[model samples]
Target: MANVLEPYLYLQEQHGFGQNKKSSAPGEEGSDGKRDGEESSDEDNQAPKEENDDNEDEDGKSGSSSSDDDSEDPELAKLLRENSESPSSSDNDEQPRSQPADTERKGKGRFIHQEYDSPAGNISILMIACWTMRFPVMYMDFVRLIEAYELPYLDSLRLLPPSLTLHLTKQNIQALSPHFAPTPMHMHRLTSRLAKLMFRSYNILTPECNAAPLLWRAVRGLQGNPTLYTLTKQLAHTLSLTLTIHYSLAPKLKKLKTRDPEHHKYDNAPPEVSLAATVIVVLKLVYGLDGRKRTPKDIHDPACALPNLSEYLIAIKELEERERKSKTSILSASSTSSALDMDNDMLDDYLDFCEKALLPRENRNIEHGVIRDYFPLTRHSSTPDEGVRSEVFEDSLPDAMSAVRIHENSSDLGPGNAYAIYHTQDVLGSLPEDYEKIVNRAATWAGVEEDYVCGVVERFERRLAGWWDKVRREKAETLGRVDDEVCRICIGQLIQHD
Candidate 1:
């Protein structure tokens, strides 16, 4: 199987995953078509060393003599004179720092920031398998199902690469006029086995699987697409409802006070449905899809931006209703076949959980809501009215005008206002005023200890910080040689602050 997959994997490798193209090699001709060798001059070569020497001298002078010290003191006078006479002494004490090897070699190699591309490439493989095996059905029929069900096709496809699109189309076309078509029974059996295999291989049912990247791509692709944005919000809401069920039922699974003889009847573990639903919700929320709005189009219009989305939503609502009805019937029915009973019981439990969870807390007479209430909506509202704003371009106000505007806006600001918006202090300060309260509330809603919630939040913050640091480092390393302003913005100020 590995050997069979090697060719497909190699093909994916050639495209360098889903990343933007690797930047041009260092020491090569730049965007202006000037070679690095040609761009260098005697003045340019001498300037950095000269600047470093001046900086070192200034540092030595400042460190050796402070204005607060008595200039007439014998020890202070001696130290100042020695520092003035031997600037090299101070330079030597400040160890000769070497530039990072990674900084120098960053864009020189073929694999610049390769990790960013890995997720898309990896998920594409799973998507390809689904496409080739027709586990759910042919791509066309799947699209038709989307149309019938009213799912967002373009938004989903935007998350996938063009390669997958081509493959799906080709495979579907071939299947339509194939040499022969399989009988319905054979097709069903094949699809069932393939679907099972794919799920197992991808570990879709397991909590250990890292589906974050795939979810990220899906959410990222929602930019500029209002139809997809609306669909994602609906999906997110559905996921939230599913999570509510899991939290509500978790405590009821075990009752310490119950001594009834019929207690054993309720001892069975909760269905995996809640866990599955939670995973879906977490992935979507983590990847920045959480909001609400009305559907953008009428359901029946053939030319609607998102054709069948209304029908798909309606179908989902109907299914939920049917599931609710079935749960009531199944709970009351007294069938004793264990296999049949277990399957029906699991489905019924899951449906009941979702139905109960979706209702408002006040309406349902619940004292607590879900964990979602603690967090802000991950999705941002679109800025449709405003055109693009430029910082230092022709479209921007002149520097003098900009400075005046800033002065006017920040007239009452303190020294802290000087910090950049992305600075650590500013970022951390932006958190909710009652951070512990929110954490505790969420923990109570999720039926977990506050400490566990705090731990998760800390870990997530650490990971986010690390991610941002890596991005900043990469951006700094790739700073252009020709642009001093760019260098100052990307590297100089960042390094000085650090």
Candidate 2:
């Protein structure tokens, strides 16, 4: 009782309990005297009989009113009461609103890029495996096998050591060669066509050069055969302007003098002037206006001179007039028509030159007295510029020049200082007799000479049989020298000489 009374007394002293201020609870008004009076009156009206009953009722009312005063207002209390009410247990199992699929989470299951460490020794081994066997028969067999096996074996094989990958790739190519023979003539035509296509592809001017190396390699490979090179070179000379323009190798009306400054054509001419001027001079020569009238008797090169020089000069004069007018109305409709007509004429002349050699017929030949200026023609066989010719031909030729011989001059075979690493009795001695027959048959089918193939196989067998013996015989320092030599040879072998 004391403790309870003490707390009540503290509240009364601290907060004026009897004479109320604002009531804090729900359904209760701010209490000055009015609210207290109203509460008392309500209690009085309820049941007033005995003094003891009245006291008990008043005390009960006071406690109830205080509790009520501590609670929220009715509106707020109603809201909170509704919120506090627990949702039905069944609501826990209710379905929710549909959600969008998580694309990023779903996409994580795809392939990833991984790097593998490779040693220089491994790279050297791979270089030998792939390139030393130049168009080796194993390559053809492997390619054919891929057709049979698909890429499953191949993808897995490359994932192995790099040398193994190279060996497998070579085998694949060798196998596929029969299926894709690519005859020399057809290859030539294909390369020429591809070169023309590359000339037209705008991608060359773009930032990416992905296709250039491929195109260049194909063309180089096609040109590897000599006959193809001759055909293209001849085409270049006779129809120089037209062909260059056709391939867009030369800009229209742009001069192209030789890079050599001492050449007569390059005397103080503006950079743009040489290319166009050279083309014009060549064209003039082709048209018989280079101070020479080639008659039908001049049948050595008919494509050079068609009509007489005067007629060609007159035509050029007319073309020059059109060129002058083109500058004023460039890119306009009229100028465009004139330009097209001129291009068409040039193309026609170029085509005629290509179809027939520039030689006149016997009937048009000059009698002993015909006074025509003699123009000495240089033989096409001789290269005018040795430096340029060598560079260009070296890139295209199948044979290497003496200066650039890529293959190391192998000394007459020194004693084959053969050494084996793995144990032999465990590997070779245990092989069944049938293995030789299988290997022999495979080698035969792959186009290797039986004796040579057998030699390599026997060498391998020997290595397996006497591995420990060989290892014991060779000192570690000597082995190091041998390894260094092997590496140099392997690297040297990769150079494509031809």
RMSD of each: 40.2, 30.8
TM-score of each: 0.18, 0.17
Give the clashing residue pairs of candidate 1, or none.
Answer: 149-312, 150-308, 150-309
Q: Candidate 1: list runs displaced more than 4 Å.
A: 1-408, 411-433, 480-498
Off by over 4 Å in 2: 1-154, 157-229, 236-498
Model 2, span 349-420: residue lDDT tens: 333332222222322343321122242222335343663565456444433211111212433211112212
**Clashes within 3 Å, all models in order:** 3, 33
User: What TM-score, to 2 decimals, does candidate 2 have?
Assistant: 0.17
> Candidates' lDDT values, in order?
0.33, 0.32
- In candidate 2, position 433 carries an lDDT of 33
Instruction: Give the 10-residue window scoring lowest on summed lDDT in candidate 2.
Output: 111-120
